[model samples]
Target: MKRLIHFAACLACFTVFLLGPTIASAGVSKKAQSDFEKNLLGKDVKALLDMPAYKDGLDLYVDHKVDKRLDERGIDLKDLSKYLKDKGVGVERDEWVTITDAKIDSDRIEIHLGGGGEGHGASKNAAKKGAGYKRAGGSRINFRYGRDLTDADVQADTFLPLLGRVLDTSKIIGVVIPKDVAPQFQEAIRSRDVVVGMSYQMVLISFGEPDQKKVDDSTDDSLHETWYYLKDGHRWVVKFVNGKVGKVQVF
Candidate 1:
C-alpha cells in the first residue's frame, strides 16, 4: 500500500511537469494568432483608426511608450500614463504600422507595434522599417462628382469593375468587393442603395456607417441582425441573414 501511494504521487507530479508549458501556451489557439497576423501586418494606421470594426473594440499596443512632453502643438502631458492604462486605443495615431508580433490571451489580442520614428509617419521607406506590405501607388481615393452626372452617364459596367480591380490589386485589408458583380455594386454605390444580396461591406461604402444596430435571436429559426440609418428626415433599416443584407425597411 505504501509503494502504491508513492507511485501515484510520482505520476501526478510527472503529469504536471509534462503538461505545464502546453497548458500555459494554450490560452489562445495557433490559428487565431495566425489569422490576426495575416489580416493586420503592415497596414495603414489612419485607415484603421477610421474603421468601425477596429474602433468598436480591437485592442492595440506599441513597443515605444507614449511621449508626455508638452510641445508647441499644445498637447497635454498630465495623466497620459493613467489614460493609456485605462484605455488601450492610442496606437492608431501612428500614420502606418508594421505588426512585429501578435500574442493572444483568452480575452484580447496584444499586437506588438513597430512603426516609423517620430516625424517619420510618411516616410517612403515603410517596408525597410518593418515587415509592412508593399506600398501601392495610391491607397485612398476621393472623387467629386459634378451635379450634371447621373447613373446612366457613369457606365456601371466599366467604372465599377475598374474600382474592384484597383481594390483587389492593391490588396488592401478589409475592403473586399466581389469582381463578378462589380456592375451591381457600382449601381449600389452610385445610387446610395441596397438590395437583397448586397453585403454588409457594400452597404457601408454605399451609404456610410449606420446610426444604430441591434441583434435579434427571438425566433427559433436563425439570428437576425439589423442596422438603422437616419438621413435627412427618413430612417432606413437594413436586415441581415447570415451576414448578407436580406431586406430593407424605410420609415
Candidate 2:
C-alpha cells in the first residue's frame, strides 16, 4: 500500500514535469487577458484605423481568419459592390464606427463591426417595402498570432492598441484637402457650410462628391469651376475661380 502511494506521487510529478511548459504557455498574458475581459469584450472600442465603411458597411479582415466570408454563408454578396458602386458615401472617416460583436478563440479574436455584414432578410425586407435595399456594412477583423500568442502581440496591434495589428486597409476614402484649406474647414464640413474663399478642394472636403459640375471657359486666365449640390429641394451653387471659392448661391 505504501508502495502504491509512492508510485502515484511519482506519476503525478512526472505528469507535471511533462506538461509544465505547455501549462505556462497555454494562454495569453495576464494583462492581456485582464484588458480583454475588462476593457474589450462586450465593450465599444474606436479601432482608429482607415476603415471607411459604406453607408451600408465595409468588409475588413485581419490576419486571423476566423471564418469564411459571409457570401459563402449563402448571402448574395456578389453584386453588393457593383450595386453600391455609385452610392454617394458611407460612414464618415474618423468617426466612431462600431464593434457589434466579437469572438475570442484560443488563438485569436474575431471582431465584427456593423452586424458583421448584410443579411438576406434585410435585403428582402427592403425590396418588399418597395425601397432600395441599403444594408449597413461591416468588418471582420481577426487578430491572429501566426505562432503562440504572447502578451506583447495582443498589447500592440494595429487596430486596438491593446490588441495586435489590424491587417485590413481596404477602401479608405476620406475628405480630400488638396492644399491648405480654410481655418473653418472642419467646422464647415461639420456644419455642411460652404462660403466664399473655401478652396475647391475644401468644398469637396466639406461636402462629398457634388451632384453636378459645370466649368466656365469664357475667361482666358482663371477658369471658373461651378459645382452644384441638389438634394430634397435644396440647391447650392458654388463657383470656384483659380480653385478658390469666388461665389456661393443657395436656392
Q: What is the TM-score of each candidate against the true structure?
A: 0.29, 0.35
Which lDDT tens digits does candidate 2 get at residues 131-231? 23333564444545445565654552433532322321112212344445545665565444688888766677666689999988864877888999973
- Root-mean-square deviation of each candidate, in angstroms? 17.9, 12.8
Best by lDDT: 2
Off by over 4 Å in 2: 1-17, 20-25, 29-31, 37-96, 118-133, 156-251
Q: Pick the candidate with the highest TM-score.
A: 2
What is candidate 2's CA lDDT for residue 35?
Answer: 64
lDDT of each: 0.45, 0.52
List candidate 1 segments past 4 Å from native.
Answer: 1-182
- In every candidate, how many clashes are there? 0, 8
lDDT of 1 at 203: 88
Can you write out model 1's per-residue Cα lDDT over 107-178, one digit (the tens) per residue? 333333342111223333432333222332222221222122222223334323322321221222334445
